[model samples]
Target chain A: MGEFDLITRYFQRPAKRSPLGVGDDCALLAPAPGMQLAVSCDMLVEGRHFLSTVDPARLGHKALAVNLSDLAACGAKPLAFTLALAMPGVDESWLEGFSRGLFALADEHGCELVGGDTTRGPLNICITVFGEVPAGAALLRSGAHAGDDIWVSGTLGDARLALEAFRGTLELPADVFAQARMRMEQPAPRVALGQALRGTASSAVDVSDGLVGDLGHILASSKVGATLDADAATGVIAAAASCGLGTEILRTCALSGGDDYELVFTAPPAARAAVEQAGKESATRVTRIGRIDAEAGLRIVDASGAPISQRFGSFDHFV
Target chain B: MGEFDLITRYFQRPAKRSPLGVGDDCALLAPAPGMQLAVSCDMLVEGRHFLSTVDPARLGHKALAVNLSDLAACGAKPLAFTLALAMPGVDESWLEGFSRGLFALADEHGCELVGGDTTRGPLNICITVFGEVPAGAALLRSGAHAGDDIWVSGTLGDARLALEAFRGTLELPADVFAQARMRMEQPAPRVALGQALRGTASSAVDVSDGLVGDLGHILASSKVGATLDADAATGVIAAAASCGLGTEILRTCALSGGDDYELVFTAPPAARAAVEQAGKESATRVTRIGRIDAEAGLRIVDASGAPISQRFGSFDHFV
Candidate 1:
């Protein structure tokens, strides 16, 4: 199919939130009064972001889900998104599966596809998502205070465990691998938890490039440090329990394993009940595994608050 | 350098307009009251949108320019943009030149770089640009009316001429080829003209995929037809005069050559003076090239009212 035909057949839809949709030179979206538009972009490349053998449907889901994770971090309501896709060729079955998975999640969040581009090239999926948050209400990374309790919504590090298993660096039984692989492929963005923590959380960031590194972003931006409970951190990864992972490997994956789309946020000690209420409200597990400090750098600690020696570097795309 | 460092060094800057910029998971942009956001995305793949031999700076400029051209078509004022880029590896010199060109055009248009993603892959540049226009005031392709005088801003098909020269399909003198190449590399978006023609022009579109094809979009969207003056269209190619090109080649390039990025608009016959005034206000040349009709398909004719004997097909990415 031609570019326009391909767009029309698979991607184009009747836009609900936008004034103008996919066919126009520009899509028009009007944020409601007292609302600010929250925008974020993510690009997924084959072999870098995903494996070549990945299901097209899951790839599409992960593409939008990662972008949605940004919105979740910001405590914003998703409004619309633009997907610019480049592919080696057009495969009808792949497009069908991809679009199905893409629109399924988008519809769940009420995020309309507003505008995008399709071109023939190496497989790449670039998505820019738009969301709405009330003025001055977004959860920013700079809001974390020294006395705030660092909380992580949902689990982490399972994706990285799956990656290591895929790379043959680790081994897992069939059932364990299946579960870990599912976590790697389909991560649920904690949108409800993020919104619930809009006013409660002092600061927030989605754990994309591992919890330690992403939390470090909050620390750096807020000019505060954190003392992370390494043992408690290991408790978040479900795969570790099934696979009988060792302490060192679990610590490594829990600290440096990337692609976890969970939110790592901070709230004051007095608001612990409020944070627990938010977790219940969103129906997502909330784990308190760290504490913000006045110190300058992140310090890893055990259950008894003793410092751990091993250093972990988070995943970096260019590096 | 790592991904974060690379972003900090080359892409991140103090955002002038956005509430939050690149450091965060999402960027926040608040539009003025009664304004609607205009968004569009374009993906440029190596060997598809541009030649690999082209300068990185110009490639960056063209990447943002094409997206801005979409905003211009809708008579939207530039706001902010997100760039999602993937490349084989990190090259400092290329990033320097690319960022230089990107920021130059972005600064000119007052468009802030809000947020984006960068990763390792085959070369691809995906940019999603945001603009704002008064609610219900965007010039849409569906706004055309029968008997509206079709107008084009600046010149068209010079980029196509340069492409033909590069492809060994046409010959041009050294100076002419240089001038055409500049047009190909740096086609300035008509932002000012689009803003000026906000109310004056009935309908509008940017001619990226040749005048005939792009104009066909307007005609199809408006459920109308147009009689394009082939002779007048031929007069718009600057390279024709410089190279002493034949009428047939001139017509073909003028009609079907892609990458022009000039505005093709429709205005009422009585709005002729207003159209001219808009062009003058924006310091752009306006040429009357056609007239909208009640019938449905685009009809090309000479100044003498005779239908052009030759048929031309617009450039399609996939054949």
Candidate 2:
């Protein structure tokens, strides 16, 4: 079949949420009245963002999920998206699996597949997501205050642990490995949690490149500092005890591991109750792990309140 | 430098036109109060959409220009765009040239670069563009009627001639080759022509594929057929005479060659004056090549009024 026919067969669907869909030159979208459009683009390349042997269905889900994480961080409701894909050649089975995974998540979020282009080349998937948020309501990394409580939703470091196991640097029980691999392959973006914490959270970011590194973005953008509680941070590492990991290894992964896709946010102490309520409403666990500070750099402190000088680096594509 | 730093240094600029730009998780766009947002995406891969030896600046321009052509076909005015780029390594000089070409056209069209991702991989460029048009004013391919006149903007076939020479299938004089090569390397998207024809043309499509193939899309969408004038079509080949091409060769290239980025539109006979006025307002030449018909399939007739049955196929990547 031709390239266009392939797209029509696998990717094109009736766009219920968008004004116009795949058949047209351009898809049309009308934002809710008095709302602003939130747009973000993310590209995934084979052997870099994903493994060559990765399942097509999971890869597709992760591709769109990564872009949706950006929108969730902005507290925007999912609306519509366009995918631009390049592949080495046509593989009908691969396309079928990929589209099924993609549409499943898209349907869950009510995000319509609006328009896109497909061509032959090395495998690459680029997705641009569009959503809407009331003016001035989007949670940004620059809104943190000096005294706000730092919080994180869900868990952290399991994806990184899974990667380590895959690379043969570590080993775990079969059940633990499977669970960790699932976290690595298919991240669930916390859209509802972001929308719930819109007014309550002072500043927010999604943890894509480890907890400390992603949180550093907020600190840099807001021109503030933070003091991460060592014990509290370790408590957020899911499955560490079950996996029989050492404390040092657990701390290293929790602090420096990337691809968690959890929300890290800050709110004033007075809004603590509201933040917790919001988390409960979204069915995501909220953990208070630190506090924003007036100082200029991030510091990790032990139970005795002594500063720890461990370095935690985030994922950098160019590095 | 890290990937984020590279983006900030090379791609980021003061986004005066957009509500929010690069630093945020999602760029914020607020379309004109009564206008609808039009979105289109196009992807370019190394050794596929372009030659590896091509100038980086031209490649950047073409990547965005192709997507803009889609917006133009929908009669949408440029607003903003997001770029997702992947590369094998960090090359400072390459990035400089690319961003320069990209921004030059963006500045001319007032389309702001808002938000995107940059990752390390094989070279790939994908751009998603956003535009705006008044409600119900877009020129759609399904709007053509059986009695409408078909018109094309700008000359055709030069780009195809360039490709043929590059592929060693044809030879031309240096000057003719240079002119044809320019057409293939840098196609000017018919943004103005499309915007001007919003209310005048019955249906419109940008000529990325061959004229016959792209025009067939309009026919299929509108459930109509067409009769192309062979002599009139040959006259639209801009540099064929200078290149010493035969009539048969001229006809083949003009009708079946792609990458024109021109506009092929149809309007009723009564709207002929309006269509001509649009072409004048847009400062683009318009040529009448055929007429839409009540018949079920396309037909081409020579000056002697004899039907030509030879086949002309358009470029299809998968085929």
Candidate 3:
């Protein structure tokens, strides 16, 4: 047994209990008439998720945003949240900026800041978000079906590329660099897209841990397989090429990087046009990348219809 | 600015925003429609909150119980929760016991297990609780009025006494020892008493950091003062005398030692009987030991009406 198993053992069986239980970003709760509650939590450690040098405001925003992304995954409308903050010492400006950024997003989402605690410790932030969804309708990763199409919202790998830029391993044109940094510093949680897909999406998950790995979640939960057309994903690179990003670098970044906070969802063949229409209505773009299959493995195929050998993995904390 | 202020500066002003906001155990949130939400969070460090040798099952129960105590303080009904756990390694039996204990209370309270994260680190357990109360009905620390009769549900000092025994600083009689340890290991959150007191009590708080200290929270929030009758509190010790506890030790433990998890609330003098009657209906005992006053200081008076002095402070993370 691993530590996760220990934690798992302590939890009630998710299957017989909650519609969505321990493993998801937040639980889908329908406690009363007409209203559904979405609850999610995320924790950011000092060294693991961010460097000490990162702006405190960005840290705070990221902490809340990560949790909000969970709500986005469930198509839950943001309602309110509590913050549990632990820090070794107080820094005024850092907190001001952090709270400013957090509240900016929260206010835009109509999320109320309710209750929380501030304690003395090494810096860490734990945020619990509560939101509401329509009763009897919530998106889940397990709803993907064979023959359904897979779609990803927004571009991927920009956040990862930004990290590489921060680490001095990657260089890009100034405009592309600014765009990559924006993807990292301020991620759009795909809330509108998720809400649009509430009735249409077969299965959905936010791509925080890279595209292939997160898409793997959909396949595993749906008990199906998938074949991805690399060119379709590389289309993001084609779009970035106008900003002077190398297609190869863009392809690698879009495929294997993490923390994009975009929604990757599956829809039935017939629902594709409707989904695209919904996205258009919301002024958001949707791109089709693959199709769910009856087989039991994931394979990425090139434009020539041959399997690509390049490996893909996402950010795993204890891997 | 201190680290707390620095971090908090980023957050928008919580004034008039939360019925109960930052710095409380759980946040009190008013969602749309019928129910208001009570939310609280607690984190237990490996060495600070408990010993590694302590039963993991008890630790899990206490972790959840402590947070529920916060909800209980606000007179809220339990709804659901999320747990964020960090541990170095997995121990199957320990995990089994822990989860069993956590679920036992959750089942009893009808609080569903919602969402959580499991990761590798030094042992820590952070649990956030969500509960509901009717709108505008949450018992707050700020509602006590001058001349209000202050009452406590259940006895106090048992948890602190148990800590003494656990540390080998004191030896207690067998039944007394068992009772105290049980108080420490499995605190009973006063959920029933809180719900029962909904309309009658003007102000309320749970005694986690000892009577004097926790009551001070009520005083500060309400901007009222209090005079505790030491003799009446001694009467509680006399009640415990049947269990073999001395009055002096009990008084000190009750006043300064923490972790009681009992609700200390204030009601108008005329409502005393109603409060007691409600307690009777719920089968949870209520004891009136003090009164809210117009002045702004805390005083503990002996049976003869003389002040008693003590050289102790409530629990502080940093001294």
Report per-candidate DockQ: 0.91, 0.87, 0.13
- Each candidate's clash count: 0, 0, 15
List, residue by residue over A122-191, the lDDT tens digit for candidate 1.
9899999999999999999999999899998888788998999999999988887888898899999999
Q: What is the DockQ score, from 0 to 1, of model 2? A: 0.87
Instruction: Specify the highest-TM-score model's number.
Output: 1
Candidate 2 similarity to native, TM-score: 0.98
Off by over 4 Å in 3: A1-33, A164-181, A237-253, A281-283, B1-33, B89-93, B164-178, B234-250, B316-319
Instruction: Give per-residue CA lDDT, model 3, range B34-82, as digits (tens).
Output: 6666677777776667777888778878988988888888788887677
**Over 4 Å off, model 1:** none
**Model 1 chain A lowest lDDT segment of ten:** A238-247
Model 2 lDDT tens row, A235-315: 877756577788777777888788888999999999999999999999999999999999999999876778877777889
**Candidate 2 CAPRI grade:** high
Tell me the TM-score of model 1.
0.99
lDDT of 1 by residue, B141-191 (tens): 999999999999888888989999999998999998998899999999999
Deviation (Å) of A287 in candidate 3: 1.8
What is candidate 1's CAPRI-style docking category based on DockQ? high
